[model samples]
Target: MRVGNWIKLSHLSAGFIAVLVGYTSSVAIIFQAAHAAGATDAELNSWMWALGIGMGISCIGLSLRYRSPVLTAWSTPGAALLATSLSGLTMEQATGVFLFSSLLITLSGVTGWFQNLMQHMPRHIAGAMLAGILLRFSMDLFLAMQTQWLLAGLMFLTFLLARIWLPRYTVPLALVAGIACAASLGLIQADGLAWFPATPRFMKPEFSWSALVGVGVPLFIVTMTSQNVPGLAVLRANGYQIPATPLISWTGALGVVLAPFGGFAFNLAAITAAICMSPDADPDPRQRYKASIWAGVFYLLTGIFGATVVGLFAAFPVELIAAIAGIALLGTLGNSLALALSDEHGREAALVTFVCTASGMSLLGIGSAFWGLVFGMSVHLMLRRSIR
Candidate 1:
């Protein structure tokens, strides 16, 4: 595609906002992971750098290559896994683990193992997993009201009114309105807001076979099966058909560069990326790649004001975050749930997948995401084979 036929700056701005909203709203939990790992401010910025650089390259490169919306973000579930699992490991040790994990995921993508697994996923089950992923965020909308009534209520109302009247601008406009209300209401925190830009610190790579297996292996599995697989599915379902090899390689290279800077690992986003890539984002699909690009630009901004930006994100009330996110995801969640249960032949297995994932059950340290897919696919295949 010629540069003239491609999106203009205006469309790029819109696309960036779509990604910024999608990525930031969901990644608040990343702070928890950083804190749990005892990361210093520099390391935190490194985390941002790793994540931002990775995401920025992927957004610009992937969208340019696929000519579709290919917004990638850090794996939220993997972040959650780290928040729980990073306690005992040193930052350097964790870095070692991060590097090892990323290499494995890169290999999976290159060897087509990851792609092969995704090809086996039934449409219905994929849909169910998508729905299951969004289910928590959707529920967060209402839950946020209990803590910050006025702030969340206003945002919720803004979302509802815009959704009813002008669906396209609901999220962007509501986000602006929420910031205004927050600033006026004294909800914005200026304390400890730093001067000067972030300085990223680098750590040399170290290796430990024990840490590799204990932490690295789990990280790779969680990032791949739970994050990237479904992330690609989002792109495919939306009709973008970029080959998978380059996407994986790029993500891995980004990981390698950022690992020393407290970037645990980066992977394809499933739920959050869906938010930026959805039809609800804008009526024009060709234009949607702009969202990922815009998201990348914002991510770059995030890298600059790494410290203060976290505070800015903190300003929005939980209710507003949840409401905006949930409202944004309405179309995606609905679509996934519909597909998950729609196939009679795959119904039983898909239902198992949805129920198990939704149940939030974990066994032997494996997430429900992996097991849910496993359970669903097992039943799906069994049912298929029996029919033959």
Candidate 2:
């Protein structure tokens, strides 16, 4: 097929929105994580470069290979873990911890243990978990309206109208509306934007049992459970049958190679992947990979100009990002809910998972997604006999 035949305005919009939401949401945590490691300014830029390049390559290559929308992201939860846990460790030791965690992730994939575990995951449970994971973003749409009513409200109204009149372009149109409203309201700020390319800085690794056990192990666990699990669920929930093994293995491998340059962790993306997988990205699911390809292109651009891109994204008001992200995800959120509740037998268990995950409760440094699945599966198994 010709490139023009597959590419659409909606795909580009979805790609841009996915990157925008991914960066704006958790980038501050990355900064905090860097600070915890006592990283210099240049090292922080290198971290962004490594993460951006890793994600870009993974996303583009995997999507093309699998003919599916495969998105990857830096491990936000892992960054959060590092932010608090990296205090005593020097930068070299921290790099070692990252490598150790990534090695574990690679092993999990290479051994097929992670794939086997996910292969048995019930569809309803996966759908519920995905819905639970995205609940916060959708809720933020209305929340943004409370703070910037005119801006967010206009974007939402545009979304509703576009869905009725031009269904495929709904998200793109809503995003444009948000940007226009923000600009009119004097909310767009680009006062001190700098344009500089990012350069990678590699640090030598220094391993220790304490750092590995305390930091590395937890990062591996969190990245796998919190990020990759939900990411696979997002794919399965959206009807993609791409195998998990390669996806996990490739991300882990990339993480290991890039760790010295501040690529702390790389895993499948949950929320952003949904944006690419949704119908709003492309009416035909087979062509949705184009959306992710565009996302990868944007990721490359972000990596090439790391600090500049961050500042550019910062220029947009928070309400605009929140509104557009929520609007774009509306279709995905609705569909996930439908799938989660479609089966009468698993409805209760799925509902349990949805609520638990949506509650956003984390325990023992692990995220709610893991706990939610545990509670959901337990309820599912217990109720299985009764439903029969």
Candidate 3:
């Protein structure tokens, strides 16, 4: 495909929103995790570099190869786990743990364990989990309205108007309207903006059983359950039929390669990927891969800029970010909820999944998304048995 033919404004908007939401949502957790591991400013920059570049490379390569919107992301839940569990470990030890966890992930993919698990996942249940995961952002839109009413209201109204008038241009219009509104309100800050380029700094790994079992194992589990599973669910729910094993394997392998440079963990993205996969991204599903490619280009720039990207994103007001995310994902959220409740037999179980996952409750160091799936599937099985 010619570059000129493939590129579209809608595709570019999808990619921009994916990066914006991805960065604003959970980047603080990544910062916290780095701090816990005693990472210096340079090391933190390295982490961003590794993650952004890894995602960029994987996303571009996979999407081009498969002609599908295959986006990769750093594991947010894993980073959250690391923030709490990595207090005692040196940066070197933390790097070692990342390597260990990635090895396990690679092994799972290579052996087809991850792919098999995804294959058995029922569609309604997957849709419910996705809806649950995204509920917080949707809620954020309203919560921002409480504090920044004008900003939120305008963005929301813009989204509504665009949906009615332009249809395919809804998210882009909303995003532009929100930013313009924020600028008018003087909500964008320039306090931390700088021109420092990102440089990768490598730390030598120091392996230990304690670090391996405590940090590495939990990271692997969380990344698999909370990140990769939901990611695949988002893809499948959105009508993509891409293979799972290769995606998982490549993510893990890339994670291993970049671990020494402070890349903690990598997996498929759920929420941001949904943006690229949604109808609002592009009316034609065949052209959605262009959005993924654009996202990769943005990721590559973000990686090259590293810490500067964080500050630049931070400059955008929280309300604007939340509003844009909620608006961008509205179409996706609606579709997920609709599909999740479409099957009469699965409706109740899907509802349970949606409620639990949306509750954001974490137990036994695992996120609500995982528990929701388990509970929903159990209920689904019980209902089938009762009917029999």
Query: Which candidate has the top score in lDDT?
Result: 2
Q: Give the residue spans of candidate 3 off by over 4 A.
A: 1-47, 60-105, 165-169, 199-245, 259-297
The weakest ten consecutive residues by lDDT in model 2 span 361-370
Work out the TM-score per prediction. 0.72, 0.66, 0.68
Over the stretch 1-388, how does candidate 2's per-residue lDDT look in tens digits? 7878657899898888888768755675577678889988788888888988988898899999999999999987677567656876799999999999999899999998676654677878877876776677678889998999999899889889987998656766777788788888899998988899999998999998777876787577667766898899899999999888888899999989999999999999998889899898998999999999999999998898887765665688887876776776576679778989999989999999889877766556444666677899899999997768
Query: What's the candidate order when arranged by decreasing lDDT?
Result: 2, 3, 1
Model 2, C-alpha of 5: deviation from truth (Å) = 15
Per-residue lDDT value at 304 in model 2: 85
**Candidate 1 C-alpha lDDT tens digits along 193-250:** 6545556779777776656665576567657766777788887888778787878777
Across 6-58, the per-residue lDDT of candidate 3 in tens digits comes to 67888998998888767755675577689889988889899999989999999
The predicted structure with the larger TM-score, 2 or 3, is 3
Candidate 2 lDDT at 369 equals 60
- On the 0 to 100 scale, the lDDT of residue 335 in model 3 is 73
Q: Local distance difference test, per candidate?
A: 0.70, 0.82, 0.81
